[model samples]
Target: MLTTILFNPEIEHYDFGPGHAFRGERFASFRRMYQETLAHNPHFQWASHDESATDEELGLWHTQDYINMLRAASLAEDDEDSSVPEFAALFGCGPKTGPSRQSLSVYVSRDNLNPLTGRLPEGIENAARAIVKNSMLAVDYVLQGKTDKAVGLGGGLHHAKANYGEGFCIYNDVVIAARYAMKAYGLERILILDTDAHAGNGTCEAFYNDPGILFIDVHQTGIYPGTGLIEETGAGKGKGFTVNIPLKSGSGDAEYERIFDEIIFPLAREFRPRLIIRNGGSDPHFADNLTGLGLTLAGFWMIGDKVRRLSDELCRGKCVDLICSGYNPDVLAGAWISLIAGLSGIKVELKEPVPRIAADEPAEIADIIYEVRKVIKPYWKCLG
Candidate 1:
């Protein structure tokens, strides 16, 4: 029942720039609020990170060439002589389309390159590597029984791919942590539940053909890096192992809870994974600057409750949470408090100034759920 909250001040350097929506200030804001609100809670303890992920650790999910490319870009100076922009362009640096065979990173973020220097922010690669290491440390904490649950406050980088960064994500920390848990602990099945407002396309791509990992992503469809479809059930040996519940815009707590009850819970019971990874921050809130999903503070609490219940039921309470994506720092702070409270089995009523928005029609939600079940029925007996 103990939980470790991962921390590292250096992760603040992950910011793109002053005007970018995602800023490093989020860490400070959330930390202050978390300490003020929940510092006294006996169930939670803080764990600070001491090192960045090594080349070998990152190599678990990222290619060596891509790693070198990111490292080089991270060190580039803000001058005309710097080829960082060109390197970024070759990889996917700007908003507009890049080369014909460009990676998804091209269309994911408009701020990947510095406007002034056309180079990535210096030391960002270090922050990203630190995040990967923090996430992996959380996994180690849970698997090694140092704590029943742990939260990598800097993780949830689901958009980074094997050979390219995407959606402002420089490394696929979620994937790397999951892979590390399996490889280091000899686990056969691991469950990844991503509830980001945008689809976890990079994470999906990494495990599209691997059956040992079950990745269930519930995302708002038709958003940035749009790729999660109901038909994207894992291919090859991973068929049925991958499940995508692409909800319509404005889908709220009711829809999310039902998806977990009808699909997520059953799948976990059947798969019986040794570990559960809950990824995503608080971007699904109605007031979020980016994306348009509607999840109030209470909704996030419910989602966390479900994840905790499942962990207790199936995995001996071993769960790693990656709270890694909220544009509005204040909202992210509130939502995370509620989520962590639920995960710790603490009763807390969180009040947000913004009211919950109306959800999609029940019929619409039902149809979406039915379609998801039908697509994965071949793999899960609970749905049948």
Candidate 2:
């Protein structure tokens, strides 16, 4: 398979703090996995590189004022207080329930935990730029017909809004890239498939009424930044285009497969987007402390297969599988590697024992699926 992945070692500079959930080590672990995978699969061909996004490109989705706030946060004030009032307003960073440091910009050391004490590392901008640039690069690869698929290894960062960034996310990368594809690449239909444990609120918000983008997110209900209710379909002409499946906590692989076979597949066939950008977060894995879903590594593999099939059948194999959230180091590493295995058209059945976690009661999962179908049925003829 011809695939392109946008990545760089410096992007790991986008670290929050010592104890934050979105740690820099996550990428380091993935890098280790990448090296091991290449060693094993010598024939596997992938184009990987580092790319940066300019200020103008960021404005594609973010407001100028919001961009300025992030810029200021990237720099520490001379007062040594390190607090930017605007940063708090934008990212909810303040005294309690926020970063340990009062500083707006993070100037961490090589460990990404110690402060460099020189120029505060502008890792947020560096990481956010990678997200946006990789997203766009993935699109470019498909548009140019160089590859049928790509992977921009980063978070969906779906919690960010057009005007502000929040929920461990600095900017909405998927939305900016979708907009880029539409305006620059002349593609009319795009789908944002977010299977994160948390709702893809920012992505849904960006295209709620735009009709051109179909946002279907299946997430654990009542999580942080909760907003993906079944009734919260798109507004105005965008109604029916926005599909949200609010799965109950503890829902597992069986429940996910049911939704895909029943709802997502049908909807995608009807909508027929030119590109599908999947925010493939592994936080739903059973081992993660951050989420309640019990999705196993095998489940992650299935999703990669499903995405590949969708791309091949619907969008001429034009798909980008972005690496999103997953906190547990061991489980996250396995889940992501298996996902890539599936994307490469290889079956994944790990020799290691699968971790066990609670599965949502079958009846409860069924009920939620039924509820989602009921609401989306109004907008789509395939639901029936």
Candidate 3:
């Protein structure tokens, strides 16, 4: 299977700062690991480009007002203090170094500025746009048949909404890419599978009333930006298209496997999506700094393999993967290698620093599965 891998070193400019939980060095780190390990693999192809997504393309999902917010935040250098704190708050700007009222800037955190120069990184907006550009490029590669599967190393920014950004995400690349597929490619049925440890709240909101997209989010329960509840399915035409499978904190490989087999597989078989988009990273690993989910390397591989099989069966092997999150750099790198290897059908072994944590006997997520199945049963006969 041919896989198109997109990477650009400059994409690291999106980092809030070195000390922030989210760092830009992840792009370079993953590239280094891939070169040392899978560089010689002929099945894998590397592609890099620096084109930022145009305003028109971004307007496919984001509003002009929100787009203006990002541009202002990106270009604000105190050369012209154009920040309106209340307006910025409406656009989902986080608090700055001081209180929100006192700080009239959206991008004013010490972590957001350069410690040496006390200025935001030049062209930070371009870095964010580069992610959108490459992510959309992945969709094009898969749909255009340039490759059966494509990976956007800079995407999966699922937390950005139409008018607001959250979860360290400045733009919702996943939603933008999906919207591009629908509008540009005329795809009616598309499935987005979000395995991020946190709920894809922005993505969920974007498609909550649309039936064309099936969004399934599997996240750790009670995490930050928590909103994906079992009964919180879609509304109107999208009543059952939004599926939230919130696993408990310690759930691992066995639990995830059960979820895919019982819920995801049945729904995909029925929906028969024309394309599959999978996002998230190794944050679910036990060693991750951000979340408490217990997935190990093996579990990551299992999830990738499941996506591979599903894509092969349902979408003619067409899939786009966004390697988007994970805090522990070493563990994140290993888990990504395993995950990609599984998706590409390549054989590779990863040695974990710690032993795998076993899931609770009988898998405590059984109740979650039952509830999700029951909630989505009316829309999918396969579940019944």
Candidate 4:
């Protein structure tokens, strides 16, 4: 059975307001798609977050001071105007840094008012903990031979840093789950496959110098928090552990699939990880306003299917997926459904045209991949 973990209640408090581009409706859209798909397919076994993680668990990847700061901000209990100044400086909640009224226009209708007071509710920490806990549960379930693959649809806050939260993310759920897998489950080699529109900067930072974790990110170049250059391989022992493939803005099916075949697959074979984690983000669709990547729904299905096959072949059918970034509700829904179908071994047909190429894709991207292969060739098999 496919174990699927969902933090449905966490979506309620994690709102970025009605007008924000990262609106809550995206989850609703995904839920709709899930229900529709389930009506026809009944292989999935849905599970929710059971026990919230404790402060000690969260401290595995986050600083205690940062956790305290978030807790204090949530307990302020002040008005929106009053709370803005205090939390803004501590948590990057200002108009310049945080989600502003303008960004809301992309997702919500005009004239939407801010519902969140820049402060979380009493159980805010519990909510973040729940996301991490559910992810960990999914991993445990997969590792214990209870399931071959599992997915957490409500986690994958990749942009969150070790000390501070950003990009609508509070805690880096995937990092916490990966850590649990390594320390608690006795998994030596772990692979994180991030196919989001944005880079997995936080995850990269956490395991930058650790050879135990193999991190691979394929995202849009020159995007927000931009640091996933191909040359930024790892430092010291982690030199070849980190692989970044910054794709061109409009790179759709061909470019993405090519990178997977040439780079990701070969590297995974070399690493021979015990478990594989996927950061699945659907914001690269042409319909999404966040980025310019023009991947179709079918394209997403193909990539998801390919990743699933890779995990089954290389990692003994142990894979866990976390939802990352995806804004456009329609695109997010369609792409997520397609991914779920592929993960369940359902065949899909591609009927759409290939996406247009981006104008800003530097010629150096290819060169960067070549250099990365050279650096990591000794560690992984099938690199030649």
For TM-score, the strongest prediction is 1
TM-score winner, 1 or 4:
1
Model 2 spans > 4 angstroms off = 38-43, 77-79, 82-122, 349-354, 360-363
The model with the greater TM-score, 3 or 4, is 3
The TM-score, computed over Cα atoms with residue i paired to residue i, of candidate 1 is 0.92
Where is model 3 poorest over a 10-residue stretch in terms of lDDT? Answer: 96-105
lDDT of 3 by residue, 71-186 (tens): 65566544232244555534545443211323423433344444444445455667878888889999999999999889998788888777766677777889999999998899
Report every candidate's CA lDDT: 0.83, 0.74, 0.82, 0.71
Per-residue error for 363 in candidate 2, Å, reads 5.8
lDDT of 4 by residue, 1-384 (tens): 464545545644555565566665676777776776653455676665557667787887998766765555444444344424433534655443322323322222221223454334334455566777778887888888777778776678787677867666677888999999998989999999888888888888999998999999888888876888877788888878888887777677777777788898878887899999988678877667788776788788877788788988998788898874677665677787777667667754434333434544434446656776877676566775
Displacement of residue 380 (Cα, Å) in model 1 is 1.6
In candidate 4, where is summed lDDT lowest over 10 consecutive residues?
104-113
Candidates 1 and 2 compared: the better one by TM-score is 1
Clashing pairs in 3: none
What is the C-alpha RMSD, rounded to one decimal, of candidate 1?
A: 4.3
Model 3 regions lying over 4 Å from their true place: 79-122, 355-363
What does candidate 1's lDDT look like per residue over 1-384, in tens digits? 788999777798988876677788888888887888777788889988677899999999888777876775576443343333455644545543122222323432445654444456778889999999999999988998999889998799999888867688999999999999989999999999999898999999999999999999999888887899999998899999999998887888888889988889988999999999999999998788787888888889899899999999999999999987998766888888888878888777567966655654442788998899998998888888
lDDT of 2 at 164: 61
The residue-level lDDT of candidate 1 at 163 comes to 81
